[model samples]
Target: MRATLIEVAPRDGFQPIGPFIPTDDKVSFVEAAHAAGLRRIEIGSFVNPAAVPQLRDTAEVLRRTAHLEGLDAQVLVPNARGVALALEAGAQHLAYVVSASEAHNRSNVRRDVATSIRDYGEIVAGLPAGLRLRLNLATSFDCPFDGRMEEDLVLSRLDALLAHREDVEVGLCDTTGRADPDHVFSLAAKCLARFGARTRWVFHGHDTYGLGLANVAAAWRAGITGFDAAFGGLGGCPFAPGATGNVATEDVAWMFRRMGVETGVDLDALLRLATRAAALPGASPGGRVRAALADRCAAA
Candidate 1:
């Protein structure tokens, strides 16, 4: 099966790091990822610069990468204000994040589940006809504040969001990185069976428990073709305590390629990107492939 890997290194990967990455460095990172054949890349988020200073230059980053051929640039939008900013900056694709757990939602975005949904509907209704919108269900699996979430709760929220706008894509986020393979497969299977054709499903996992790749495989078997990953596995939820970075882009590419599934990414080039991302100040690489390959080369 062919899958689409959305590289989120410039945004997700850099956000968790404490130091501020120069705007030029972020632009270079996005360009390198695009050069490695990543068609979709989350460049940055339109959030309060006071909250996440690392991504303060999101608008500038988007402007710098707007000319990349065959690249679908996406930015995370928190509310209608974010949508307005993104549109002003010429962003065609915008992702809004809403947590399945009410407590987490409040903590992350300062709104409860219902309020977030209401806000999302307004944003959807106001979008241009051709604009692409994605609603990310953060804490779809487990919530640091509320514990494990019920599958029905997740689906019900999805149903409500779909009722407001069926065109929006859905992304299931394991914000706490607590999802097991079986649980991932079951929820993903149910979501696909119910809403497969109406909306696109994307899985975003964190490797905090070392099961990120396993969960990705489970989701894939359940008919999911879209995934979000970061170079060198760098990212963590700013609201969810103990959450780690996302599954490494190079690692996911290697897994899919080994399974005979095409991801359209160049493995060697991705590893190089990972290495460069890890070199950024305050950045740490959590991926396994780069180190493993280095060991093999040394042995040779």
Candidate 2:
């Protein structure tokens, strides 16, 4: 199966930083990812500017990249209001996140799980035809506030989301980076068994515990082909305590390529981009491949 890695560096990677990344720099990051052969990217989020000042110019970022051919620009929308703004900005793909843990959901979006589900339903219902939507089940593995979430609870939340819109893609998120290989494989197998042909499944993992690649491999073995990653491994959940950077895009691409999987990404170019990303203010590079590349350079 062809593996697809969705770049989230422009959005998730930059969201937790204190200083706002320049709008042009954000655009350049997207362009660099595209140049590295990534087709899909989450450029920014459409939420209250006061809440995440870093992504305040999401619309402008979208406008600047509107002419990029064959590139799918995705944006995170917190609710119906974000959905409206995303549509106004001519976004074709929108992602909504809701944690499985009630406490985490409330903390992340200031709404309870049920309310977030209802809001997602409203947003899904109002979406125009042909617009792609993805639901990120945050804390599917474990929650910082509530501890490890049960598989049944995650499935139940997924059922609620499917009930709202059966076609919306689902991404299992390890919000606090607490997922292990066995747990990831087990839950992914169950999810695939439940929703295999009905909807697409993507895995979103963090490397805080240093198991991001292992978890990704586990998910792949469980039949997941789509993944969400950030360049230089830069990202953390502002609301979810102890959460850290996401699985790095170059790291994932390198793994898949070495495994004889088709990722359609240029590893050398992606490593170069990772180097550039690491130089960004407050950026932290978290992928092993980058260090390996640095060593190779030093040896050369």
Candidate 3:
């Protein structure tokens, strides 16, 4: 089966860079990705401007592109207030993050896992009709504060998220890049067994330990076809100390292209985007394929 890829460079990948992505360029990036065959993308986050200055113009950006066709523009909302902001901007798809480890959850969202889940439920309940919700269980594999996390804790959290709303899609986060193939297989098998066909699973993995691709392979074998990837491998977990960047969009696309699995993304275009993005004030992309792409571009 073909994998469904969500390009998150404009949001998850770009927000972590030193300087904020210019509003115009942010829109351009979104447009470029769409033109390159990425139908789904996380456009921005709706959080406190002080917390994530890069996403401060999320509303403005969304307002301008609200009429774009053939794109599922997603926004990340950290709380009910953020959800309200996203809804105000007409975001059709919303993503909420909750860490599986209690320490990470408290540090990241200032709430325990249970409270965060409850808050997400409240957020979803109040959204307008036709809006979709996706909950990303961050730190599902391990935590910086508490070290390795057990599969049971992650499963329990998934159960809570699924129980809250049957329509909610879930992404298992390998925050801190602590996941291996075995870990992915075990957690995914449990998720598939528990949620069965009711749940749609997406993998949100980090490349901290260089196991991102292996974990992706494991998830694919476990029946997951959707994944969250950052352009140029841009992004880091703010809550997890020493956590590395996310799985690179170009690297994963390159792998998929070579394997004959359709990701519906142009690897060459993605590398161009990554190379340019990496030139930004503090944007250092983590994709291994960027150097080669840069050389090719230079030669041309």
Candidate 4:
């Protein structure tokens, strides 16, 4: 079987890191990951620099690496202003994030879910043609403030968002990393059944409780092919309390490889990049395969 692994280490992984990664280094990481066979990569986000100081140079990074052939080069946008900044920087693919849990949404964006969805509708109205779109539904499975999210609530939120645009890729985020495989499978199944043919789907998971890969497998079984994983497992939600890094890209690739799935990612090259990510100043890296396979990859 075939699957897609969207590398988010640069955008999602680097956001919460305390030290500012040099612009040239960021560009190099994107380029290296592309060379390692990752066609789609979230370069960075178009948000307030004060909020996420590490990615302040996202536009520069995007511009520096935009020449990579066939690279999706995704940038995340939170509102209309972010959409403007991204488009101004010539971003072709934009991932817009909105929380499904109302309380978490308020805490993260200082607005209610209704207001965010309304903003998305307006964003869609003014968006230029030929620009690719993705919606990251944060806290779709669990929230630090509200606990486990209701499946119906998630579905309803999807219904509302898809109303504005159906030609989008939707990512269900386990923002708190408290989701079990059962919940992950059930909600993903529901989303696939309800909106499978309407829009593209992706699963963004975390390893806080060590269920990240298990949840990924569950989602994959439910027919979700695209997934978001950070190399070196370097990520967490600044707003979501107690959340940890994303499911490791190397770990996910390892699992799929053992199962005879094609990810188009070179694991040895990924291990090398992941080592660099782990060595970054102030980096709190997580993931199983990188540590276990280090000697093996080195000798190979």
Candidate 5:
């Protein structure tokens, strides 16, 4: 009944903030999310610190999280160099992002679609068998600059990636938050049918146009359970201009619990994490439900 949740607050949620977040605050955020029972978390990205000032403390974050039990600490690696850095830092799991849209992929990672796929295949090939590698396929649903993404393109890319390496896990990303229920169901159905039980699909929804919740429902019905939700909805796509934050962790967890789906997440403790998020400089906590929950906690 309980579905696995990947808390992306540390990597996806914190990276897009306009101001610099203190490294200690980042540690507090991850620790609080762990207290809320988030077993899997993408803690940091091994990108250039000059490019992403927010994640300049990637090594430091990894070091602090090394001793935490019952936690799957992950880092995002864009290429082999990043992968090497992640492995050096003792990350048990690594996530690599590849975009379905060719233009977005180039803009985000400075590589064309084919080259990016090749790059990812190399990363997957070289990774130790026991370590987990998650491929986050961004712009799976739609792209701001490039209109709607073709399902065929997404599947083609998946086919190549899976064919190259069988052990990789795939994550479908609503990069611009432009996805709807129908889109989510169709794409997810395609993925589930093709992959069967061999691969796990993780849904990454953005609440940009208010379709995030509906998309989650569609994904759930399509048998896609694993998801990426940020605490207090404090995350956005750096590449997609004007994209909003992710679905709030508390909101999604509340929905699943009401529908008799167990998330194994403590809403009260999660709300406290959101409060801590709000205290971080430049973090707005865009989720309405999270704000309401925080208010209730304050009143109590």
Candidate 6:
């Protein structure tokens, strides 16, 4: 089976960089990623300019890429204000994230978990018809502030979110990249069993401990086909201390290619993109395949 890869370099990968990437270049990235066979891409987020100056040009980026055919442009919306901004920017797919760990949630969104969950329901109700929705449950297995989370607590919070909207695609996020593979599989299996009929599942992992690929395999074994990955592993939670970039998109694609599980992504094309991502000023890129094959590609 083929894995559905969502390219988030434009949003997740670009946000942490200190220097602001030009909007034209950001739109070009979305176009380039789509050309490489990724139909789904996180274009940008609708956050406050004072908070995230890098992505303040999200609406312009969205307007520029609106003409791309078959491109599923996703926008990350944190609250009702973000939702309104995203809708005004013409975002058709929305990714809403909240942390299950109370400490992490408080630190990340400046609110309690229950308050965030309640706001999510209000956000969903006000959305226009035919909009796609995805929910990312961050710190699903571990938290930077709270440490490792047990299954019951995670499930109980998930139960609450699903009650508000069960049809949205659910993402089990390894926000801190400190999750164990066995624990990942166990939680994913339970969620699928409990919510598979009503919703879809995806795994969003980071390679902080070099176990991102392993956790991805575990989730796949648990029957999840969708995944969120950033090129050159370009992402880190601003609120989660000690967390690193995400599971590199090229690394995940190569692993699946070797396993004969068609990834549908062009690895050579992905390498060139990764190289560009790695060169961005103030950007800390992470991925094995891009470096391992860089010399060979240059020599060839």
Best by lDDT, which number? Answer: 4
The TM-score of predicted model 3 comes to 0.95
lDDT of each: 0.90, 0.90, 0.83, 0.92, 0.85, 0.88
Question: How many clashing residue pairs appear in each of the predictions shown?
Answer: 1, 0, 0, 0, 0, 0
Each candidate structure's TM-score, on Cα atoms with residue i matched to residue i, is 0.97, 0.97, 0.95, 0.98, 0.96, 0.97
What would you estimate as the lDDT of candidate 6?
0.88
Those runs of model 3 whose alpha carbons end farther than 4 Å from true positions after fitting are 295-300
Residue-level lDDT tens digits of model 5 in 56-92: 8988988997777888898988888889888888887
- The true-versus-predicted C-alpha distance at residue 58 of model 5, in Å, is 1.2
What is the per-residue lDDT of model 6 for residues 1-300, given as tens digits with 9 covering 90 to 100?
789998888988898899989888898788878877888999889988887889999999989988888988889988888988988878899999899999998887778999999999988888889999999999999999889999999999999999988999999999999987898899999999987678999999988999999999999898889988998889888878888899999999999998889878988888888888878999998989988888633311
Instruction: In angstroms, give how far residue 293 of model 5 lies from its true place.
Output: 3.1
How many steric clashes does model 3 contain?
A: 0
Per-residue CA lDDT of model 2 for 151-211, tens digit only, reads 9999999888898777768999999999999999999999989876878899999999999
Q: What is the RMSD, in Å, between candidate 2 and the native fold over all Cα?
A: 1.8
Question: For model 5, what is the C-alpha lDDT against the true structure?
Answer: 0.85
| Strongest candidate by TM-score | 4
Q: Model 3: per-residue lDDT, tens digit, 1-300?
A: 599998887887776777767899988888777876888889899988887788899888787776668888889988888887888777889999998999998988888888998987787677788878888888888899898889887887877877778667789988889889998988888888888887789998889889888888899888889988887788886668888788988888888888889998877777777776666778866878887666643311
Candidate 4 TM-score, C-alpha based: 0.98
Worst 10 residues of 1 by lDDT: 291-300
